[model samples]
Target chain A: MVLASGSMALATRTERTPSLIGSVWRSTVGKKAVMAVTGVIMLAYLVAHMLGNLKVFFGAGEFNHYGAWIRTIGEPFLHHKWFLWIARVVLGSAVVLHGVAAFQLSRRDLAARPAKYAHARRRASYATRTMRWGGVILALFIVWHILDLTTLTVNPNAEEGRPYENLVASFDRPPVTALYIVAMLALGLHIRHGFWSAAQTLGANSPRRDRLFKVLANALALLLTCGFIAVPVGVMTGVVS
Target chain B: MNLTLRIWRQRTADAAGAMTSYEVSGISEDMSFLEMLDHLNEELILAGDEPVAFDHDCREGICGACGMVINGQAHGPERTTTCQLHMRHFADGDTVDVEPWRAAAFPVVKDLVVDRSAFDRVIGSGGYVSVPTGSAPEAHATPVPKPVADLAFEHAECIGCGACVAACPNGSAMLFTSAKVVHLNALPQGAPERESRVLGMVGAMDAEGFGGCTNTGECATACPKGIPLQSIATMNREFLRASLRGGRGA
Candidate 1:
């Protein structure tokens, strides 16, 4: 009896160790951690992208050169535009993972509360309510942004090298500028709640750090929104021309 | 005080439920919410009507046996259990909406009563330490530090009334599960089973069809015991640690 029980215990231990990653992806908390990590990854990329977009304030020569420099990063060891491709792949993976986790979680959320309250009162904050819809807005924006800028497929000018001119061409249209502004605003709201939520999911938040994280989240949302919107505003006002 | 209460009424679990309105009068401000319900029930029985069905054991707040969403707020707007929510919080001639805890894991058993066995199953998974029961052990022998003991006590305040789940927009029970996990995992006596406790409890929680937490703070805000939202964060830390460092065999 002792030998059989011992073997059973051994089998259970072996069964658990091999499926660590699988288990993490399967559990709700674990899937949230995946979403949190990917969110942080995307947040970091957005910060860099926003900073790069701000180079337009320095005029066409510097802005175009900055665009070219992104392609030539890690030139000695990496091929032309290889760094850009690598960054795209990493960012693409993060977006996909974050989106998938969010979709699954949202589906589960809706399912859990099958019955609606008779007297419905607005419970969470507006930023919290907007997370799912804001994420969708951001996703659609990313697609359109890539088409307009990266491939130049939807760019009014479709210029390959002159990013400054291409940006000006795109945002020069009133409708395009309005769409960009709305998407950037949605992005701001998403980050306002999302950054602090990511901190909580990743187990980094505490009573002491809660206020700090909230302040940081708000600051990031405001900073990124203003920075991204500045380029379109600069183009429309003839400041970057 | 005269009040119009629109309480959820279902004859059975499988029956179609709807808001059934009842006019109740002469309710004292000092009467607890449940006592007001009791008065309504007394009137209903006198009129030969089926009274409202709700779950309540101890009329005091600590029992965790009583819970209902009053006017869309869990327990009530007063941040106490339904048993302790006095009628004074409601204005005279007000229309009060009463409902049960609504979650897939916590299905309505009857009017204003939900089956909360999901919580019991979650606790049964690994909410206890393996203590031998021959003789009473000396308290000082375990040597749990004061801060750790305080932390454990704070989480131990969870009454499993299912308010967190009811208040959560997503119907997430992360707060309740986290309270149980953190309560036991903090003490020295619970050290040996800490890793398994988190894993088992989390697995049970997921299997119970509860939603995932989105960190909206709804659960924390509605919690009557004042369980902090940081408990979920603490549990996340413990779950990550347990997942990284594999638990002992089942």
Candidate 2:
């Protein structure tokens, strides 16, 4: 076995093929690229999800049909609910990859600077500083959100297969609404930093484009926050009732 | 002016380091920050004690060799190199905390000296332009535009100090790597190897165990050379283009 291993090593010396994928995943830049790509995927889902949520203002029939339509997408060609399940699978993987990459990167960062500065001064903004905690809050909120809406397990007035009714019922309670509003705020902060950061990681930023990107990031954060929170506010104000 | 300094004392690279306090009186406000340290060191030597060992050369701030975290800042309270920081910034009897650059890639050698040779390695990876030795070419042969020249010069101002890594909460070396990438990539002569350069430098940067950039912008703020934050974005753009072109197996 030792002789064979030695021969293999000698044969490959100075002429081994570099595994590009392995190198990319192993480097910090590569991990950042993964995070940026996954972030964009999640952002697309958020926008589409926000647009779907706005259908609540169009009344129960429209909102319910929209919800049902998602599951029935690709019906004749594919199995019923297959499209929705596929989306869930894709989004679930993205979330897992994003979370794992973030966790590992953060751990590497902590290890890089094992000693803390005695009188360390912060040079970053509030959003940049709170990114870790904000990510944690968002992660926790995702679990609660899936339970309350998708699975209908923790929702007090969950109606099976009735997304419109379930959303209204969940938001009808003040505490749940408050929790959701808080989560939305955290999401806003996350998006505010994440959007601009992803653009940078993906190499889309320049001196001329920097201001535009910042404005777009802020606008997106505001739009998403208002869009998501509007559903709960609509419930509280009886606008969607 | 009298001052109290709490400087990090490490006997060797493998030895555990800690903050050690020292008192020095009659320090002049006209003295540079390093000169104040010199006074302290002289006192330590006079008393037959081990003097604090720190890195510095070309006290003019252009060398990029001198760096220390003073009162939690990469170079000092001012956005200048430690050697350039004057004693006037501090009041009499002020307590200053001095420490070496604290990144895993820049381990403390002793006192305020860290082994910044990792930076040299990252540079050796691909930070240089490869032109065969020959007679000087015509000055305007390349014909770089004014804006491009200015931008390249801006990035070229980076002194290779490890302050960016030290000031960063994550100890990221993006600013340094990006500075080199932008400096060389902007030149017309650099176009040939631009893709490979960025790939090799970024690969080496990550291999050195430096943290990833989260866009905190601290490195730019802490950079003594005033290397702008946009250099990092420019490097990112170059890296992306190279990766898309299959230059580094993206």
**Deviation from native of the Cα of residue B91 in model 1, angstroms:** 1.1
CAPRI classification of candidate 2: medium
Task: Compose the digit string of candidate 2's lDDT tens values, residues A1-241.
Answer: 9999999999986433245676567778778889899989999999999998999999999998998889889989989999999999999999998999899999998888788887767568887887889989989999999999999999877887678889888988899999999999989998899999988888888878889989999999999999999999999999977
lDDT of each: 0.92, 0.88
Off by over 4 Å in 1: A1-18, B248-250
Top DockQ hit:
1
Q: Candidate 1 chain B: minimum summed lDDT over ten consecutive residues — where?
A: B241-250
Considering only chain B, report the TM-score of each candidate against the true chain B. Answer: 0.98, 0.98
Best candidate, TM-score-wise? Answer: 1
Residue pairs in candidate 1 whose N, alpha carbon or C atoms collide under 3 angstroms: none
Error of 2 at A9 (Å): 21
**What's each prediction's TM-score?**
0.97, 0.92
